[model samples]
Target: MTREIENAAGIPVVQIATIVPIMLTVGANRIVPGVAIPHPTGSPELGKAGDKATRRELLLRAFKAMETEITYQTVFE
Candidate 1:
């Protein structure tokens, strides 16, 4: 993982609450709040019609956000 990100410039690695606090304390740039433990994409219970639609929208938005070139903080909330 470290080898792959050697040329990533200023990438910020984050985990759940444990690593999240540490990352934030160190002033890292990005933190992606994962959806779940075993399944990050989603689950069937929360993937009902409406939920799936919302998830799809969120994914699309995340993808679109990758196009932006800003250097500030942003949250999906």
Candidate 2:
């Protein structure tokens, strides 16, 4: 689906998922390692402020992944 969106629509995609191996196996070109399965961006245990910070960091990484040029599948861990 990611490849199809990129290929057919000409839009770069960054996939944020906890199951990195599965995304890679499925041929996701740009992947970001999510924090957890339930909460893929922020950790609830970190409290409000910390969770916000973590989420920000994850978003930044995802943006970076979208900006990067790659010939094959890559993980922004």
The TM-score leader among the candidates is 2
Model-by-model lDDT, in order? 0.46, 0.91
Which pairs, if any, clash in model 1? none
**Looking at candidate 1, what is the lDDT of residue 33?**
46
Every model's TM-score = 0.44, 0.92
Tens digits of per-residue lDDT for model 2 on 1-66? 887888898878998889999998988899999989999989899999999999999999999999
Q: After superposition, how far is residue 53 of candidate 1 from its true place, in Å?
A: 2.1
Cα RMSD to the true fold for all candidates: 5.0, 1.0
Clashes of each: 0, 0
Q: Write the per-residue lDDT of candidate 1 for residues 31-70, one digit (tens) a residue.
A: 4444555554454576478567755755665565555454
